[model samples]
Target: MSRSTFVATIEPVSTCPVNCEACPVSRRDIEQPKARLMSLAVAGAVASRLRHEFGVGYAAFGNWGEPLVHPQIVELLAIFKQVGIGSLYLTSSLSARIDAAALVESALDYLDISISGVTAEVYNIGHRNGDWERVEGNMHALAKARRESASRLKIGLRWHRYRHNEQQFDAARELAEQLGFEFKPYFGHLGGIEAHEDFERGTLPQSKRRFIENSVFLEYVERAVAAHVGEGSCPQAENLIIHSDGRLLHCCALMDSHKTGIDFLALPRRVLESFKRAPNSHCGSCLAKGWSGFMHSSKVDHRSPAEVAAELAPSSAS
Candidate 1:
């Protein structure tokens, strides 16, 4: 988020192929203009700028959607390598092809597979319409690949925590360890999890709630140290968050069209300069809370190709 050290977060697609019922994007009413898939040129250019110019060390290929779903995902990784990106991280649901053989041989630094429960029925509560059988099969494939390839990929089975699935942590961890993968648990926002107890009761305090309801500024600092994400003066960020379509995002959590700010494709240089000058207002706490007294925003496709081309084309506006 700062000018000194920046990281790149890209969502290759707004819509995921898997229909996880609890996923916010699965809400049929939600709509945001998303790229059909990340174009090779855009991926290459962004990676180059961050690595060659800004000296970024890593590029995470996922944010909201599954990164592996990209048709050219491996190719995209090649772009990062080509541009001197130091490392790569990928997060996926493992609902589709989990070609472990290919993955173990790739240049990825980390691979996180999100799973909520161990059993098919239990996993379905969070994953919704998921196949536990398929997950197990793919994980075995991954383990086999790791054994054969001697890969150093930091593979982990990320468990999204919920009231029901919390009990399965031990078995899940054991399974992960057996398969040469670490088992991690995290509270997903979609499970309606929050950072505080105030969310559950109807009487959420008005004062502590001002950050989202009335957030003043996104706190960003380089080399400055502090405590939490809500802490402003602390040097917290390592990357410049952006959508593949070119909106310079405030953070990975808030991707809704309204929340995303600046069209980077049209004014790449200008947007970079603007973010350095001004703190992001749409991030940190939140600004999209509604009748439920909770944060919510639903838009992702923010590319403006026509405008981007106009800027690059030989025109007087340039």
Candidate 2:
């Protein structure tokens, strides 16, 4: 089967500064503390493979860590563009200092700023240890820089909606509009890959489960899980995830331990396509339990829980 679209998510930096509650990178138990930055040479090689071999349409930098933390992030973005990758983007927590003017002038196509709340009290619930003041200031500076330079770089404010932060959605959206940014609000989920693994094994920690039950929109999660039940194929098969160390991941939902062992730079497209067709045990488990669908931001259902339940009733009966 030929895929029409392919995406590559490259991790520019391995370590994150902010300890977000929902992110596995923040948890030492899940993600061992290791600081690694992808060299420009390696990034260029990866970008070449993605463009020349896989014909990747979209490339995203930063999966586990904050891309802005990298001192030469602008150069990294430029590397992908230099390799002819069409759409290049990255998401940032905006907790660290960044050269907004340099970024605006870079080859980046889009920048998504991840924000949980507008205020410190609510923001700290998820973005623990993150400096709200710094994030706010960076947001404004980036907007100003884009306007001043007349850059076409699309800026989006991705607000993670939690139970406590619902009331702050309009305020955040208003701010995004005022800054000429695209406002996107979606329900937050359990942060770590370990959390999803534990949930599947029924061994999720009580504290984590409580966080999900309280903070997340349970109905939306249920619909998302049910909508993909019995799915034999994974949408992520068309996407490639590369670690900062160049390890190729099966998908974003799995841990580093589950990496394919082949360095992305050397892995042939035929080998990756074969691997995608026959996923390992970890990927099998995720697909079987519908967590694969749940993890994708674009797979959510807007229909009510009852409507989704009714649609899935026949499959449940079988």
Candidate 1 — which pairs collide?
Answer: 6-239, 7-238, 7-239, 7-240, 33-301, 34-301, 256-299, 257-299
lDDT of 1 by residue, 1-318 (tens): 444466677777656655564454544444444646777888877777777666788777776677776777777777887788878888888776666677777878898888878899788665665677887788888888888877788897876654455457677778888988876654333312122223334333343233222211111110111222333431213446657665666545443532545665556665675564454553334322321122221211112324323433222212
How close is each model in CA RMSD to the real structure?
14.8, 5.1
Q: Candidate 1 — number of clashing residue pairs?
A: 8
lDDT string for model 2 (138-182, tens) is 999998998899788999888887666767877888899999999
Query: What TM-score against the true fold does each predicted structure earn?
Result: 0.71, 0.88
Q: Which stretches of candidate 2 lie over 4 Å from their true place?
A: 1-4, 31-33, 200-202, 257-260, 297-318
